[model samples]
Target chain A: EAGVVQSPRYKIIEKKQPVAFWCNPISGHNTLYWYLQNLGQGPELLIRYENEEAVDDSQLPKDRFSAERLKGVDSTLKIQPAELGDSAVYLCASSPRASGGASDTQYFGPGTRLTVL
Target chain B: AQSVAQPEDQVNVAEGNPLTVKCTYSVSGNPYLFWYVQYPNRGLQFLLKYITGDNLVKGSYGFEAEFNKSQTSFHLKKPSALVSDSALYFCAVSPVYGNNRLAFGKGNQVVVIP
Candidate 1:
Protein backbone atom coordinates (compact mmCIF):
# COMPACT_ATOMS: atom_id res chain seq x y z
CA GLU A 1 0.00 0.00 0.00
CA ALA A 2 1.16 3.48 -0.80
CA GLY A 3 1.82 5.87 2.07
CA VAL A 4 0.85 9.53 2.35
CA VAL A 5 2.23 11.64 -0.51
CA GLN A 6 3.42 15.28 -0.53
CA SER A 7 4.61 17.43 -3.39
CA PRO A 8 7.49 19.88 -3.80
CA ARG A 9 9.67 18.14 -1.20
CA TYR A 10 11.55 21.44 -0.94
CA LYS A 11 10.38 25.00 -1.46
CA ILE A 12 12.14 28.33 -1.28
CA ILE A 13 10.32 31.63 -1.30
CA GLU A 14 10.86 35.19 -0.17
CA LYS A 15 9.05 36.82 2.67
CA LYS A 16 5.68 38.31 1.65
CA GLN A 17 5.33 35.71 -1.11
CA PRO A 18 2.62 33.11 -1.20
CA VAL A 19 3.38 29.42 -0.77
CA ALA A 20 1.32 26.31 -0.75
CA PHE A 21 1.92 22.66 0.14
CA TRP A 22 -0.14 19.76 -1.12
CA CYS A 23 -0.91 16.45 0.48
CA ASN A 24 -2.58 13.25 -0.71
CA PRO A 25 -3.29 10.94 2.12
CA ILE A 26 -3.55 7.15 2.00
CA SER A 27 -6.64 6.05 0.17
CA GLY A 28 -9.71 5.48 2.38
CA HIS A 29 -8.37 7.56 5.23
CA ASN A 30 -11.00 10.01 6.48
CA THR A 31 -8.98 12.15 8.84
CA LEU A 32 -6.27 14.49 7.60
CA TYR A 33 -3.94 16.83 9.44
CA TRP A 34 -1.36 19.53 8.76
CA TYR A 35 1.56 20.14 11.08
CA LEU A 36 4.63 22.33 11.23
CA GLN A 37 8.05 21.31 12.50
CA ASN A 38 10.69 23.87 13.23
CA LEU A 39 14.35 23.06 13.53
CA GLY A 40 15.07 20.89 16.56
CA GLN A 41 11.41 20.74 17.50
CA GLY A 42 8.55 18.32 17.32
CA PRO A 43 5.61 18.56 14.96
CA GLU A 44 3.05 21.17 15.91
CA LEU A 45 -0.46 20.75 14.56
CA LEU A 46 -1.76 23.61 12.44
CA ILE A 47 -5.01 22.12 11.35
CA ARG A 48 -7.04 18.91 11.42
CA TYR A 49 -9.83 17.71 9.19
CA GLU A 50 -12.51 15.09 9.48
CA ASN A 51 -13.38 14.58 5.85
CA GLU A 52 -14.15 17.99 4.24
CA GLU A 53 -14.71 19.69 7.56
CA ALA A 54 -11.90 21.32 9.47
CA VAL A 55 -12.68 20.39 13.02
CA ASP A 56 -9.68 22.09 14.53
CA ASP A 57 -7.46 24.89 13.28
CA SER A 58 -7.02 27.10 16.27
CA GLN A 59 -3.26 26.98 16.03
CA LEU A 60 -3.16 28.21 12.44
CA PRO A 61 -2.42 31.85 11.86
CA LYS A 62 -5.69 33.00 10.39
CA ASP A 63 -4.19 36.18 8.97
CA ARG A 64 -1.70 34.38 6.76
CA PHE A 65 -2.46 30.67 6.87
CA SER A 66 -5.35 28.85 5.28
CA ALA A 67 -6.09 25.20 4.52
CA GLU A 68 -8.65 23.22 2.59
CA ARG A 69 -9.50 19.57 2.29
CA LEU A 70 -11.75 19.33 -0.68
CA LYS A 71 -13.57 16.00 -1.20
CA GLY A 72 -12.03 14.88 2.05
CA VAL A 73 -9.15 13.06 0.35
CA ASP A 74 -6.61 15.66 -0.74
CA SER A 75 -5.54 18.71 1.25
CA THR A 76 -3.75 21.96 0.63
CA LEU A 77 -2.12 24.25 3.15
CA LYS A 78 -1.41 27.76 2.09
CA ILE A 79 0.55 30.66 3.51
CA GLN A 80 0.02 34.11 2.11
CA PRO A 81 2.69 36.77 2.48
CA ALA A 82 4.92 34.32 4.22
CA GLU A 83 7.29 35.39 6.94
CA LEU A 84 10.83 34.23 7.52
CA GLY A 85 9.65 32.54 10.67
CA ASP A 86 7.39 30.40 8.53
CA SER A 87 10.38 28.45 7.32
CA ALA A 88 9.89 24.90 8.47
CA VAL A 89 8.91 21.43 7.34
CA TYR A 90 5.23 21.09 6.57
CA LEU A 91 4.03 17.60 7.38
CA CYS A 92 0.75 15.97 6.43
CA ALA A 93 -0.76 12.95 8.11
CA SER A 94 -3.93 10.92 7.99
CA SER A 95 -5.80 8.46 10.09
CA PRO A 96 -8.40 5.87 9.21
CA ARG A 97 -11.18 7.66 11.01
CA ALA A 98 -11.94 10.08 13.82
CA SER A 99 -14.83 8.36 15.51
CA GLY A 100 -12.44 6.13 17.35
CA GLY A 101 -10.56 7.17 20.44
CA ALA A 102 -7.47 9.34 20.31
CA SER A 103 -5.28 6.23 20.33
CA ASP A 104 -5.51 5.87 16.56
CA THR A 105 -2.14 6.04 14.83
CA GLN A 106 -1.63 8.57 12.06
CA TYR A 107 0.42 7.85 8.93
CA PHE A 108 2.67 10.74 7.90
CA GLY A 109 4.06 12.03 4.64
CA PRO A 110 7.71 12.82 4.05
CA GLY A 111 6.89 16.54 4.36
CA THR A 112 7.80 19.67 2.39
CA ARG A 113 10.60 21.85 3.59
CA LEU A 114 9.66 25.50 3.20
CA THR A 115 12.37 28.10 3.35
CA VAL A 116 11.21 31.69 3.52
CA LEU A 117 13.99 34.13 3.04
CA ALA B 1 -5.69 20.68 27.38
CA GLN B 2 -3.30 17.79 26.85
CA SER B 3 0.47 18.02 26.73
CA VAL B 4 3.57 15.81 26.53
CA ALA B 5 7.02 16.30 27.96
CA GLN B 6 10.27 14.57 26.97
CA PRO B 7 12.80 15.44 29.63
CA GLU B 8 15.96 14.66 27.73
CA ASP B 9 17.21 16.77 24.86
CA GLN B 10 19.61 14.02 23.78
CA VAL B 11 20.51 10.49 24.75
CA ASN B 12 23.77 8.73 23.90
CA VAL B 13 24.22 4.98 24.17
CA ALA B 14 26.78 2.54 22.84
CA GLU B 15 25.66 -0.03 20.34
CA GLY B 16 24.29 -3.28 21.89
CA ASN B 17 23.56 -1.51 25.14
CA PRO B 18 20.16 -0.78 26.60
CA LEU B 19 18.54 2.56 25.82
CA THR B 20 15.80 4.56 27.41
CA VAL B 21 14.14 7.87 26.49
CA LYS B 22 11.88 9.41 29.06
CA CYS B 23 8.46 11.03 28.48
CA THR B 24 5.61 12.30 30.61
CA TYR B 25 2.15 13.59 29.76
CA SER B 26 -0.83 15.47 31.15
CA VAL B 27 -4.42 14.95 30.05
CA SER B 28 -7.84 15.53 31.47
CA GLY B 29 -9.29 12.16 30.53
CA ASN B 30 -7.83 8.75 29.93
CA PRO B 31 -4.55 9.32 28.10
CA TYR B 32 -3.79 8.05 24.64
CA LEU B 33 -0.06 8.15 24.12
CA PHE B 34 2.22 7.62 21.13
CA TRP B 35 5.89 7.52 20.19
CA TYR B 36 7.25 8.53 16.77
CA VAL B 37 10.75 8.52 15.32
CA GLN B 38 12.07 10.82 12.62
CA TYR B 39 15.20 10.20 10.64
CA PRO B 40 17.13 12.97 8.99
CA ASN B 41 15.05 14.69 6.30
CA ARG B 42 12.13 12.32 6.83
CA GLY B 43 8.75 12.70 8.42
CA LEU B 44 7.73 11.17 11.71
CA GLN B 45 7.19 7.40 11.82
CA PHE B 46 4.91 5.74 14.27
CA LEU B 47 6.81 3.64 16.81
CA LEU B 48 4.31 2.64 19.47
CA LYS B 49 1.14 3.59 21.29
CA TYR B 50 -0.49 2.92 24.63
CA ILE B 51 -4.27 3.05 24.79
CA THR B 52 -5.25 0.81 27.67
CA GLY B 53 -4.84 -2.60 29.19
CA ASP B 54 -1.14 -3.42 28.93
CA ASN B 55 1.43 -1.08 30.39
CA LEU B 56 4.18 -2.36 28.14
CA VAL B 57 3.50 -2.00 24.41
CA LYS B 58 5.89 -3.28 21.78
CA GLY B 59 6.01 -1.69 18.39
CA SER B 60 8.02 -1.45 15.18
CA TYR B 61 11.80 -1.78 15.08
CA GLY B 62 12.02 -3.66 18.33
CA PHE B 63 10.87 -0.54 20.19
CA GLU B 64 8.81 -0.71 23.33
CA ALA B 65 7.22 1.82 25.69
CA GLU B 66 6.12 1.33 29.25
CA PHE B 67 3.07 3.30 30.30
CA ASN B 68 3.13 4.22 33.98
CA LYS B 69 -0.23 5.69 34.91
CA SER B 70 0.80 6.36 38.46
CA GLN B 71 3.76 8.42 37.33
CA THR B 72 2.06 9.76 34.23
CA SER B 73 4.98 8.65 32.12
CA PHE B 74 5.58 6.63 28.97
CA HIS B 75 9.28 6.04 28.36
CA LEU B 76 10.58 4.44 25.17
CA LYS B 77 13.03 1.60 25.71
CA LYS B 78 15.18 -0.79 23.70
CA PRO B 79 17.07 -3.78 25.05
CA SER B 80 19.93 -3.74 22.54
CA ALA B 81 20.44 -0.43 20.82
CA LEU B 82 21.55 -0.28 17.21
CA VAL B 83 23.41 2.51 15.48
CA SER B 84 20.51 2.77 13.08
CA ASP B 85 18.33 3.69 16.06
CA SER B 86 19.91 7.12 16.12
CA ALA B 87 17.18 9.61 15.33
CA LEU B 88 14.80 12.16 16.80
CA TYR B 89 12.05 10.69 18.96
CA PHE B 90 8.84 12.49 19.87
CA CYS B 91 6.18 11.68 22.40
CA ALA B 92 2.57 12.70 21.84
CA VAL B 93 -0.56 12.58 23.90
CA SER B 94 -4.27 13.22 23.56
CA PRO B 95 -7.42 12.83 25.55
CA VAL B 96 -9.82 9.93 25.04
CA TYR B 97 -12.19 12.11 23.03
CA GLY B 98 -13.15 15.73 22.31
CA ASN B 99 -11.17 17.58 19.64
CA ASN B 100 -8.86 14.67 18.93
CA ARG B 101 -5.92 17.00 18.77
CA LEU B 102 -2.47 15.67 19.63
CA ALA B 103 -0.04 17.46 21.94
CA PHE B 104 3.57 16.61 21.24
CA GLY B 105 6.67 16.96 23.35
CA LYS B 106 9.72 18.90 22.19
CA GLY B 107 11.46 15.58 21.28
CA ASN B 108 14.60 13.64 22.20
CA GLN B 109 17.56 13.11 19.89
CA VAL B 110 19.02 9.62 20.26
CA VAL B 111 22.60 8.90 19.29
CA VAL B 112 23.84 5.33 19.30
CA ILE B 113 27.63 5.18 19.33
CA PRO B 114 29.02 2.36 17.27
Candidate 2:
Protein backbone atom coordinates (compact mmCIF):
# COMPACT_ATOMS: atom_id res chain seq x y z
CA GLU A 1 0.00 0.00 0.00
CA ALA A 2 1.15 3.49 -0.75
CA GLY A 3 2.24 5.50 2.28
CA VAL A 4 1.34 9.13 2.84
CA VAL A 5 2.46 11.26 -0.12
CA GLN A 6 3.82 14.79 0.18
CA SER A 7 4.72 17.18 -2.60
CA PRO A 8 7.83 19.24 -3.31
CA ARG A 9 10.32 17.21 -1.35
CA TYR A 10 12.09 20.48 -0.65
CA LYS A 11 11.49 24.25 -0.73
CA ILE A 12 13.66 27.33 -0.34
CA ILE A 13 12.23 30.78 0.09
CA GLU A 14 13.24 34.19 1.35
CA LYS A 15 11.84 35.50 4.58
CA LYS A 16 8.49 37.29 4.18
CA GLN A 17 7.54 35.09 1.20
CA PRO A 18 4.56 32.75 1.32
CA VAL A 19 4.87 28.98 1.17
CA ALA A 20 2.59 26.01 1.07
CA PHE A 21 2.96 22.25 1.56
CA TRP A 22 0.64 19.50 0.37
CA CYS A 23 -0.04 15.98 1.57
CA ASN A 24 -2.13 12.98 0.54
CA PRO A 25 -2.61 10.28 3.11
CA ILE A 26 -2.72 6.58 2.46
CA SER A 27 -5.96 5.21 1.09
CA GLY A 28 -8.58 4.05 3.58
CA HIS A 29 -6.93 6.00 6.38
CA ASN A 30 -9.41 8.28 8.15
CA THR A 31 -6.99 10.27 10.26
CA LEU A 32 -4.42 12.78 9.00
CA TYR A 33 -1.85 14.83 10.87
CA TRP A 34 0.61 17.63 10.12
CA TYR A 35 3.75 18.00 12.15
CA LEU A 36 6.74 20.32 12.21
CA GLN A 37 10.23 19.04 12.89
CA ASN A 38 13.27 21.13 13.69
CA LEU A 39 16.87 20.01 13.63
CA GLY A 40 17.52 17.29 16.20
CA GLN A 41 13.95 17.54 17.43
CA GLY A 42 11.07 15.14 17.13
CA PRO A 43 8.08 16.03 15.00
CA GLU A 44 5.54 18.13 16.84
CA LEU A 45 1.86 17.99 16.01
CA LEU A 46 0.59 21.08 14.26
CA ILE A 47 -2.87 19.95 13.29
CA ARG A 48 -4.96 16.80 13.10
CA TYR A 49 -7.97 16.03 10.94
CA GLU A 50 -10.62 13.45 11.48
CA ASN A 51 -12.16 13.58 8.04
CA GLU A 52 -12.60 17.22 7.04
CA GLU A 53 -12.94 18.56 10.55
CA ALA A 54 -9.79 19.59 12.37
CA VAL A 55 -10.08 18.06 15.80
CA ASP A 56 -6.72 19.17 17.21
CA ASP A 57 -4.86 22.33 16.31
CA SER A 58 -3.97 23.74 19.65
CA GLN A 59 -0.25 23.55 18.92
CA LEU A 60 -0.48 25.28 15.57
CA PRO A 61 0.90 28.80 15.33
CA LYS A 62 -2.12 30.72 14.21
CA ASP A 63 -0.31 33.99 13.67
CA ARG A 64 1.15 32.80 10.36
CA PHE A 65 0.23 29.18 9.92
CA SER A 66 -3.00 27.68 8.60
CA ALA A 67 -4.03 24.24 7.46
CA GLU A 68 -7.01 22.68 5.70
CA ARG A 69 -8.04 19.19 4.74
CA LEU A 70 -10.75 19.23 2.11
CA LYS A 71 -13.04 16.28 1.42
CA GLY A 72 -11.15 14.42 4.12
CA VAL A 73 -8.53 13.15 1.67
CA ASP A 74 -5.75 15.62 0.96
CA SER A 75 -4.34 18.33 3.22
CA THR A 76 -2.49 21.60 2.78
CA LEU A 77 -0.37 23.58 5.26
CA LYS A 78 0.40 27.20 4.57
CA ILE A 79 2.66 29.82 6.05
CA GLN A 80 2.34 33.41 4.90
CA PRO A 81 5.19 35.88 5.21
CA ALA A 82 7.40 33.01 6.07
CA GLU A 83 10.11 33.68 8.58
CA LEU A 84 13.52 32.09 8.93
CA GLY A 85 12.28 30.45 12.05
CA ASP A 86 9.72 28.62 9.93
CA SER A 87 12.47 26.65 8.23
CA ALA A 88 11.96 23.02 9.06
CA VAL A 89 10.56 19.78 7.74
CA TYR A 90 6.79 19.54 7.42
CA LEU A 91 5.67 15.97 7.89
CA CYS A 92 2.32 14.33 7.13
CA ALA A 93 1.10 11.13 8.73
CA SER A 94 -1.99 8.98 8.70
CA SER A 95 -3.53 6.05 10.48
CA PRO A 96 -6.61 3.89 10.37
CA ARG A 97 -9.54 4.72 12.59
CA ALA A 98 -9.29 3.63 16.19
CA SER A 99 -11.45 0.66 17.05
CA GLY A 100 -12.56 -0.73 20.42
CA GLY A 101 -10.33 1.75 22.23
CA ALA A 102 -7.25 0.42 20.49
CA SER A 103 -4.61 2.77 19.17
CA ASP A 104 -3.20 2.57 15.64
CA THR A 105 0.36 3.29 14.63
CA GLN A 106 0.90 6.16 12.23
CA TYR A 107 2.58 6.00 8.82
CA PHE A 108 4.63 8.99 7.80
CA GLY A 109 5.45 10.66 4.52
CA PRO A 110 8.90 11.57 3.19
CA GLY A 111 8.18 15.10 4.40
CA THR A 112 8.71 18.53 2.80
CA ARG A 113 11.91 20.24 3.83
CA LEU A 114 11.56 23.99 3.83
CA THR A 115 14.35 26.52 4.15
CA VAL A 116 13.81 30.22 4.72
CA LEU A 117 16.52 32.80 4.22
CA ALA B 1 0.76 16.65 30.44
CA GLN B 2 2.81 13.80 29.01
CA SER B 3 6.45 13.85 27.95
CA VAL B 4 9.29 11.64 26.72
CA ALA B 5 12.98 11.90 27.45
CA GLN B 6 16.01 10.57 25.56
CA PRO B 7 18.86 11.35 27.96
CA GLU B 8 21.58 10.62 25.45
CA ASP B 9 21.84 12.61 22.25
CA GLN B 10 23.78 9.81 20.59
CA VAL B 11 24.88 6.21 21.05
CA ASN B 12 27.90 4.63 19.41
CA VAL B 13 28.58 0.93 18.99
CA ALA B 14 30.73 -1.34 16.89
CA GLU B 15 29.15 -3.50 14.23
CA GLY B 16 28.06 -6.89 15.50
CA ASN B 17 28.07 -5.63 19.06
CA PRO B 18 24.99 -5.26 21.20
CA LEU B 19 23.46 -1.81 21.53
CA THR B 20 20.84 -0.05 23.57
CA VAL B 21 19.10 3.32 23.49
CA LYS B 22 17.40 4.62 26.60
CA CYS B 23 14.03 6.33 26.81
CA THR B 24 11.86 7.38 29.73
CA TYR B 25 8.31 8.64 29.67
CA SER B 26 5.91 10.48 31.97
CA VAL B 27 2.15 10.11 31.66
CA SER B 28 -0.90 9.26 33.66
CA GLY B 29 -2.65 5.90 33.60
CA ASN B 30 -1.48 3.09 31.37
CA PRO B 31 0.77 4.62 28.75
CA TYR B 32 1.08 3.53 25.14
CA LEU B 33 4.70 3.60 24.04
CA PHE B 34 6.31 3.48 20.59
CA TRP B 35 9.69 3.60 18.91
CA TYR B 36 10.35 5.16 15.53
CA VAL B 37 13.46 5.35 13.38
CA GLN B 38 14.44 7.91 10.77
CA TYR B 39 17.00 7.56 8.03
CA PRO B 40 18.83 10.32 6.30
CA ASN B 41 16.49 12.42 4.15
CA ARG B 42 13.54 10.25 4.98
CA GLY B 43 10.52 10.26 7.25
CA LEU B 44 10.17 8.38 10.51
CA GLN B 45 9.12 4.73 10.37
CA PHE B 46 7.35 2.80 13.09
CA LEU B 47 9.79 0.45 14.79
CA LEU B 48 7.41 -1.02 17.35
CA LYS B 49 4.82 -0.32 20.00
CA TYR B 50 3.77 -1.56 23.42
CA ILE B 51 0.05 -1.38 24.13
CA THR B 52 -0.42 -4.34 26.42
CA GLY B 53 0.71 -7.86 26.98
CA ASP B 54 4.42 -8.65 26.85
CA ASN B 55 6.86 -6.16 28.28
CA LEU B 56 9.34 -6.96 25.52
CA VAL B 57 7.87 -5.75 22.22
CA LYS B 58 9.75 -6.71 19.07
CA GLY B 59 9.71 -4.40 16.08
CA SER B 60 11.06 -3.92 12.58
CA TYR B 61 14.78 -4.38 11.75
CA GLY B 62 15.35 -6.79 14.56
CA PHE B 63 14.86 -4.02 17.10
CA GLU B 64 13.09 -4.58 20.38
CA ALA B 65 12.00 -2.46 23.31
CA GLU B 66 11.52 -3.47 26.92
CA PHE B 67 8.79 -1.65 28.81
CA ASN B 68 9.54 -1.28 32.49
CA LYS B 69 6.38 -0.01 34.05
CA SER B 70 8.03 0.42 37.43
CA GLN B 71 10.80 2.54 35.97
CA THR B 72 8.66 4.39 33.46
CA SER B 73 11.20 3.53 30.78
CA PHE B 74 11.01 1.80 27.42
CA HIS B 75 14.53 1.13 26.16
CA LEU B 76 15.23 -0.03 22.61
CA LYS B 77 17.78 -2.77 22.20
CA LYS B 78 19.36 -4.93 19.54
CA PRO B 79 21.35 -8.07 20.06
CA SER B 80 23.71 -7.33 17.17
CA ALA B 81 24.18 -3.94 15.65
CA LEU B 82 24.60 -3.40 11.92
CA VAL B 83 26.08 -0.46 10.09
CA SER B 84 22.81 -0.08 8.26
CA ASP B 85 21.07 0.31 11.59
CA SER B 86 22.62 3.71 12.15
CA ALA B 87 19.84 6.25 12.31
CA LEU B 88 17.88 8.59 14.52
CA TYR B 89 15.59 6.93 17.05
CA PHE B 90 12.69 8.60 18.78
CA CYS B 91 10.60 7.51 21.73
CA ALA B 92 6.95 8.51 21.80
CA VAL B 93 4.13 8.05 24.26
CA SER B 94 0.43 8.74 24.71
CA PRO B 95 -1.75 8.47 27.76
CA VAL B 96 -4.36 5.74 27.76
CA TYR B 97 -7.18 8.28 27.87
CA GLY B 98 -5.59 10.76 25.48
CA ASN B 99 -7.17 11.42 22.12
CA ASN B 100 -4.20 9.66 20.48
CA ARG B 101 -1.88 12.64 20.70
CA LEU B 102 1.76 11.53 21.04
CA ALA B 103 4.49 13.24 22.98
CA PHE B 104 7.94 12.52 21.58
CA GLY B 105 11.48 12.90 22.83
CA LYS B 106 14.10 14.94 21.01
CA GLY B 107 15.69 11.74 19.59
CA ASN B 108 18.86 9.66 19.91
CA GLN B 109 21.19 9.23 16.98
CA VAL B 110 22.64 5.74 16.76
CA VAL B 111 26.02 5.21 15.09
CA VAL B 112 27.06 1.67 14.29
CA ILE B 113 30.69 1.80 13.28
CA PRO B 114 31.65 -0.76 10.74
The segments of candidate 1 whose C-alpha lies over 4 angstroms from its true place after superposition are: none
* Best DockQ among the predictions, by candidate number: 1
In candidate 1, what are the lDDT values of residues B1-114, reduced to their tens digit? 888889889999999999999999999978899999999888899999998898999999999999999999999999999999999999999898766888899999999999
- Which is the leading candidate under TM-score? 1
Error of 2 at B36 (Å): 0.3
- Tell me the tens digit of each residue's lDDT in model 2 across B3-81: 9999999999999999999999999888999999999999999999999999999999899999999999999999999
- Give the C-alpha lDDT of model 1: 0.93
Question: Compared with the true structure, what per-residue lDDT tens digits does model 2 show for residues A1-117?
Answer: 888999989999999999999999999888899999999899999998888989889999999999998899999999998999999999999988833232679899999999999
Q: Which 10 consecutive residues of model 1 chain B have the lowest summed lDDT?
A: B94-103
Error of 1 at B4 (Å): 1.1
DockQ values, each candidate: 0.81, 0.66
Error of 2 at B98 (Å): 2.0
